[model samples]
Target: MNSSVITPIGKILNARDLGKLVRDLREKQGATQADLANFAQTGQRFIVDLEGGKATVRFDKVLQVLNILGVELTATRRK
Candidate 1:
């Protein structure tokens, strides 16, 4: 279960991009929104909003979901 995605920085330029990644990873693992929410200790509505790319989503929860989905986001200076 070592699935991952490698996209150029520009490809994921917004919350929507990040959400797509999360949704993809979640689906890849055959996980339902409820499953992810339970693992992240949050409500299923939170998962819905997170996966829907709602800009106001909580940062801490976003990190938690990413952690559970085995996704890591990094920051780097553009060339």
Candidate 2:
């Protein structure tokens, strides 16, 4: 996605925003938290925390999850 769309999410805690996005994507893809966790190579509990927006997850971890969900993060200057 473009940086403009991501900028608002970036301003907040990325974990929360990314978590919500992941949850939505997973649900849309008919994947469960456990399934996503396995795909992301993380614990299910972590996925729960992510989905709940209750953790300050690392950016790299968030990116990993997003990658697994086929969501790409991109940046571009806004004019």
Candidate 3:
């Protein structure tokens, strides 16, 4: 993991934040977009769109990548 990359926790402010975090994590693991896509069982284009912060990508696919990267997200009541 890059030393400058701070692991995101709690609230993700938006798609771009999520994308950056994902990209950082992927790079930390030394995995290419294609490699991550294969591990997530998703298309490379999906990974591309995801890391590029394309907001309209399917939610399930996002979960897949997060799962494969060992990032856990939990839903909580917004105060």
Candidate 4:
């Protein structure tokens, strides 16, 4: 059986697409939610909600967490 997990991104209300990106990166680094939460200096529940794509996170907090996870954000103009 091949089953894929679909994370909430563009499908949910106020869903942060970056959450999925963070979750993927964390998995690649073999880091647990608790580890990420500690690294991000946030509550584990917050991390869980973020990873689950169920959190209404603030932009600054999102950036902070991304920075803590060593995830850099780059901007580019549309061609």
Indicate which candidate wins on TM-score.
1
Given candidate 3, what's the lDDT at residue 41?
A: 98
lDDT per residue as tens, model 2, 1-79: 6655543324334557766777888999999999999999988988898888866766687788888987777765666
lDDT of 2 at 19: 68
Against the true structure, what is each candidate's TM-score? 0.83, 0.71, 0.82, 0.67
All predictions: root-mean-square deviation over Cα?
4.0, 4.9, 5.7, 8.7
| Weakest 10 consecutive residues of candidate 3 by summed lDDT | 4-13
Candidate 4 achieves a global lDDT of 0.71
Candidate 3 lDDT, 6-79, residue by residue in tens: 55564677888889889999999999999999999999999999898889999999999999998878766779
Backbone clashes in model 1, listed as residue pairs? none
Q: Which pairs clash (backbone N, Cα, C closer than 3 Å) in model 2?
A: none
Task: Score residue 18 of candidate 4 by CA lDDT.
Answer: 58
Ranking by lDDT: 3, 1, 2, 4
Model 2 misplaced regions, further than 4 Å: 1-15
Q: What overall lDDT goes with each candidate model? A: 0.85, 0.78, 0.89, 0.71
Model 1 lDDT per residue over 1-79, tens place:
4345465434577788888888888999999999999998989999999889898999999999989987677787778
Question: What is the lDDT, from 0 to 100, of the residue 71 in candidate 2?
Answer: 71
Report lDDT (Cα) of residue 4, candidate 4: 52
Candidate no. 4 TM-score:
0.67
Clashes of 4: 0
The Cα RMSD in angstroms, rounded to one decimal, for candidate 3 relative to the true structure is 5.7
